[model samples]
Target: MYLEKLSLTNFKNYEDGRYVFGRQINVIVGPNGSGKTNLLDAVYFLALSKSAFQNQDAFSILHGADYFIIDGIFEENEHSGHPNRVNPDRVQITISLQRGQRKVIMADKKPYERISEHIGRFPVVLIAPNDTDLVREHSEDRRHFFDGVLSQLDPNYLRDFLMYQQVLKQRNSLLKLFAERNQVDNDMLDTYDVPLLDLGQKIHDRRKQFVEEFLPGFREHYAYLSNESEMVNIVYESEVSDPNFAEEFRHFRRRDTILQRTTMGVHKDDYSFLIGGVYGEAVPLKKFGSQGQQKTFVIALKLAQFDTLEAEKGVKPILLLDDIFDKLDDRRISKLIQQMEEGAFGQLFITDARPERTRELLSSVKADVRFYETGV
Candidate 1:
C-alpha cells in the first residue's frame, strides 16, 4: 500500500496545501521550521490516526484555526506482476477534527465505527530524532512503541489492548474513589480484577512473544548499522511474567487502594535495552551507550519494525524519514539507501533541509524520485 497524494487544511503550520507523491520516493526539502517535519507527521497521522509529535489533536490545528483536516489517497495492490500491486485501485482516507469534538476517520467515504480498525490497513514506520526517547525516556514510551507494532500486526491484539487500557483507566478511577472515601471493597475491586487479569495475561504473553520474535531482527539490523560494533539485547520486564499475577493483584489491593492507582499488571511492563561491552558484559544502553550508539540503536529498532511489518503483513509499509539525514551517520544513511535500492521499502517520504545534498546522495538510487520544496 502507498499513499499517492495528501492534502491538509489548517494542520500545524500549513494553511491549505496539497501534495502529490511518487510511488517510490518523495523528498520534502525546505529550511528549518518550514513545516518539513510537520509534513512527515501528517503522513504518520494518516497511518496511525494520531499525530506523532503532538500529544493533543488540538495542537495540530493552525494558530487561528479551530479545526483540521487530513486527506490521503492510497494505492492498494496486494498481488504481484502489476505496477501497483495485485489489485490496482484507490482508497481514500479522510480525518477531520473540530474544536471540543471527537476526531472522525473515514475510509472510502465510510466512517469507521472504531478508529482502531483503520490501523494496519496502511501500516507505516516513522524514524525521527525523538525516537531516541525510546532508549532514554520512561518505559511507557517503549511499551507504546511495541504495542503499536503489535496492534498493526494483529487486530485482535488491538481490540484487547484497547479494552485493557480502558479497564485500567476505570480501575484507577475506582481506586481513587476508594482512597477518597477511606473504604476498601475487595468484592467491587475483584470485579475489575477478573478482566484485568485475563486480558493482562494475554497482553503480556503476546508482548513477550513479540519481543522474542523481534529481538533477532532487531539485533541483525543493529549489527548491519553499527558494523557489528556491539551486541544488543531487549528484555521484556513485566509482573505478568509471574504466573501468580492474580495472587499478586490480590495481595496489592490495599496498596492499590491507598495509592489510588494500579501498581502492577501489564500496563507497567517495560522492555529493557542492553548493550554488550567489548568483553561481552551486557549493561543498560541508556546508561552505557554513547550518543552515537543511542541513535544507532533507535534507527535499528525502526528498521527492524519495518522488516517485521513487511514480513507479517505481506506488504511493504510506507516509511517516513523526518530529518533523518541530520541525525544518522553517512554509513547508516548508505545502509538505508542500500535497502531502498534492494526494494526493501515501499513508498517513502523523507524530509531534509538541504536539497542539493539530498539530491547528490540519492543520485545512486534507482527508483522514481520526486522533490518538493515546502514552506516557500
Candidate 2:
C-alpha cells in the first residue's frame, strides 16, 4: 500500500497545501523551519489518527485558525481475476479537529465509531532525531513505545490496555478519596482490584510474549546497523515477572493507601537496554554508549518495529524518515537505500534539508523517486 495524495489545511505552518506522491520513494527537501517535518507529520497523523510530535490537536492548527484537516489517499495493489489485470483499491482518510470538540476520523467518507478503529488499518513506522529518548528518558517512554507497537499489531491488546489504564486511574482516585476521608475500605478497593489484576495480568503476559518474539529482530537489526561492533540486549522488568503479581499487589496495598497511589503493576514495567561491556559484563546504554551508538540503537529498534508490523499486518508499512540524512551516517543511509532497492519497503517519505546530498544518496536506487520542495 502507498499514499497517493495528501492535503493539509490550517496545519502548523501550512495554511493550505496539497501534493501527489510516488508509490516507491518520495524525498521532501526544504530549508530549516520550512515545514518539512510538519508535512511528514501530516502523513503520520493520517496513519495513526494523532500527531507524532505534538500532543495537542489544537497546537497543530495554524496560529489564528480554529481547526486543522488532513486527508490522504491510499492505493492498494491487488490484482483482479483476469490475466495480469489490476484493479487497485483506494482508501480515503479524512481527519478534522475543531476547537472544544472531539476530533473526527473518517475512512472513505464513513466516520469510525471509535478513533481507535482507525489504527493498524494503515501502519507507519517513523524514525526521528528525538527517538533516542526511548533509551535516554524514563521507563514510561519505553513502555509507551512497546504498547504502541503492540496496539498496531493486536487490537485486543489496545482495548485491554485502555481498560487497564482506566481501572488504574479509578483505583488511584479511590485511594486518594479514602485518604481524604480518613477511611479504610478494603471491599471498595477490592472492587477495582479484581478487574485491575485480571487486565494487568493479561497485559503483562502479552507484553512478555511480545518481547520474547521481538528481541531477536531487534538484535538482528542492531547487528546489521552497527556491523556487530557490540552485543546489545533488552531485559523486560515487571512486577508480573515475579509470577505472583496478584499477591504482590495485595502486599503493596498498605503502602498504596499510605501513598495515595497504586504502588505496582505493569505500569511500572521497564525495558532495560544493555550492551556488553569489558569482560562480558552487561552495562546500561545510557551511561556507557557514545552518541553514535545510541542513535544506531534507536534506529535498529524502529526497523525492528517496521518488520514486526509488516509481518503481523500482512502489508508493507509506510516509512517516514525525518531529517535522517542529517542524523545518520553515509554507511547507514547506504544500507537503507540498499533495502529500498531490495524492495523491503513499499512507500517511504523522507525529509532532508540538503537536496543535493539526498539526491546523491538515492541516485543508485532503481525506484520511482520524486522530490517536493517546501518553505517556498
Candidate 3:
C-alpha cells in the first residue's frame, strides 16, 4: 500500500500544506524548525494513529490551534489481484484531534472502529538520527523497539499488547493500594492476572518468534554496515522464569496476591543486542567507535527492519527518514541511498536542511529527487 496524497491543516507547524507523494521516494528539505519532521510526522500519524516521536496528539497541533486534521489517500498494490488500480473513488482517512484531548478518526470520511486495521494497510518505518538509542540505551528502550517493530507485522500482537498494558496498569494500581493497606487484593489480582496471562502469552510467543526472525537480518545488516566480523546477538529476556506457563503462573500466585501485580509475562520481556569483536578485544561501538559506526548502525537497523517486516507482514514498508543526511557521513549516506535505488525501500520520505547536500549524496541513486529550501 502507498499513500497517494497527504493533506494537513493546523497540524504541527504546517498551517496548510498538501504533498503529492511519489510511489518510490519523496524528499522534503528545509532548515531546522521549518516543519520537515512535521511533514514526516503527518504521514506516520496517518498510518499508525500515533506520533513519530511518541509525542502526544495535543502537542502535534499547531500552537494556539484548537484542532488539527490529517488526511491520507491510499491505493492498493498491483499484486493484490488488481495491478496499478487506484480506487476510482479515493479512500480518505482523517483524524480530527482537539488540543491535548478529544479524538475522532475517519475512514473514507466515516468513523473507524478498529484502529489496528488501519496500520498494516499503510505500514511505515520511521528512522531518525536518534534511532541509535535502540542499541545504546537500556533494555526498556530495546523492548519498545521490539514492540514497535512487531506491532506493525502482527495485529494479534498489537491487540494483546494493548490488553497487557491495560491489565498491567490496573494490577500496578492495585499493588500500590495493597502496599498502602498492608493486605492482599485478591479480587483485583483475580481480575487482572487472569486476563494478563491469557494475553501476555500470545504477546510473548509472537515477540520470541519475531526476534528469531529479526536477529538474522539484524546480524546481517550490522555486519555489512559496520564492516565488522564481530558477533551480534538478540535475546528475549522474559520474567516468566518457568518451563510451563501454568507452573510459572502458580509459582507467582502468592506474590500476585501480595503484590497485586501480574509480575510475570510479556510486560517484563526485553530485547538485548550485543555488539563486540569476536572473542578478542571488545571494541565498544558507543565508546570507541567513530561516528561512522554509529550512523551505519542506525541505517543498518533501519534497513534490517524493512527486511524483517517483509517476511512477517508480506508487504514492503514505507521508509520515513528524518534528517538522516545530517547524521550520516558521505560513505554511509551514499550506501543507504544506493540501496534505496536498488528498491530496498518501496517509498521513502527523507528530510534534510541543505537541499544541495541531499541531492549530491542521492544523485547516483537515480531517484526522482526534489529540492526545496526553507521559505520565509
Per-candidate TM equals 0.96, 0.94, 0.88
Q: How well does candidate 2 match the true structure in TM-score terms? A: 0.94
Clash number by candidate, in order: 2, 0, 1
Top candidate (TM-score): 1
Better of 1 and 2 by TM-score: 1
For model 1, residues 1-376, the per-residue Cα lDDT tens digits are 7898999999999999999889999999998999999999999998899998889989999999999999999888754113554467788999999999999999889999999888888889999889999999999999989998999888899999999999999999999999999998888988899999999989998998999899999999999988998999999999888777789888989998888899999989999999995687899999999998999999989999999988877788899999988888888889988988888888899999999988988899899999999978
Query: Per-residue CA lDDT of candidate 2, range 106-130, in tens?
Result: 9889999987788887889999989
Better of 1 and 2 by lDDT: 1
The top-ranked prediction according to lDDT is: 1
Query: Model 3 segments beyond 4 Å from truth?
Result: 78-90, 244-264, 277-291, 372-374
Q: In model 1, what lDDT does residue 18 have?
A: 97
Q: What is the lDDT of residue 33 in candidate 3?
A: 88
Model 1: per-residue Cα lDDT at residue 285: 96
Which has the higher TM-score value, candidate number 2 or candidate number 3?
A: 2
Candidate 3 has what TM-score? 0.88
